[model samples]
Target: MGRMSDEPARWTRATVYPDMWVDPADDPRDGASPDGELATLLDFLSGYRMTLRMKCEGLDAEQLARRSVPPSTMSLLGLLRHLAEAERDWFNWISDDDPLPKLYGERDGDFDGAVGEQAAVDAAYADLEREQAATDAALAEHPDLGERLRKDGIAVRELMVHRIEEYARHCGHADLLRECIDGRVGQ
Candidate 1:
């Protein structure tokens, strides 16, 4: 039976697949294995991005901005903003030809400014979309992963690997935060 309106929130939702957030048939992530190094990295990044979004799905602005653990201001919304800023910093701003300012005023502004307001939530998502597109476009300009950015001495391959690491770590955080929020877990 479905939940009743008068009942309190349950720790876990009743589902056929209790260990996963979605059924395998309904999962949005591209499950197919990749053929090359670049494709593999891209695939993992794409899946992590989708996973982060799924973790935040059905959550309201207040829930999105809820603090993670004690003494840490990090939240789903903050992660979104931080990732957007990171995409710009690593891809666009690092290139000398298109150096740009931080999306937020300061380095920690993403987490510090995260508020439980609809406007803030909407802005964070929009900024993420814009920054992701800009970053992708900038990366497309340099097909050779061995080529270094004009400003940063690191190769594109290193940058891609670093981004994957960053996303994977944050996705783990998202998983814990989401579980604490509603008792949902898996995948």
Candidate 2:
């Protein structure tokens, strides 16, 4: 057999000009140095959401919905839809407001029904933005992280951390998927 190739066993993120997301110093989301726990948590959550949005930026509908990975229904469009639903669900859980009816009734419907169409892509982004704004507004009404409002009695701190974790996890997925789509990687 021929000698093995000299490439590293694990891949490192590329830092080429086209692959560069933005200069670390130039990144606008670095303003997370808040003075309190709630501010810090909200800043991190918003940063991750912005990261996901950056991953989806500049892609067309078909690219956004491209199920480029086989056997995984995790297109960027689907992620947008899923996050929208998640925000809505959590907002309802933590507040006394009436939530909009389920966007996708089935468990995986958000990802499953994510068709590669401009309208669907637009709707998903719009829903995610609207739901996230509403959730933030609802959350702002409660000043204490320990406050419990919903039936499950989940504390605001727990709920906020969960939201941050959820977005962070999906952002990892989004980074990989975006790289697979166009060989673009970022810091």
Task: Give the number of the best model, judged by TM-score.
Answer: 1
lDDT of 1: 0.83
The TM-score that candidate 1 achieves is: 0.88
TM-score of each: 0.88, 0.86
Query: Candidate 1 — which residues are off by over 4 angstroms?
Result: 1-16
Superposed model 2: Cα runs more than 4 Å off = 1-20, 97-99
How well is each residue in 18-89 modelled by candidate 1, as lDDT tens digits? 677876777889478899888888888888888889988999999999888789989988999999888888
RMSD to the true structure for each prediction, in A, is 3.7, 4.5
| Candidate 2 lDDT by residue in tens digits, 73-125 | 98888999999999989888976666568877889999998898999998998
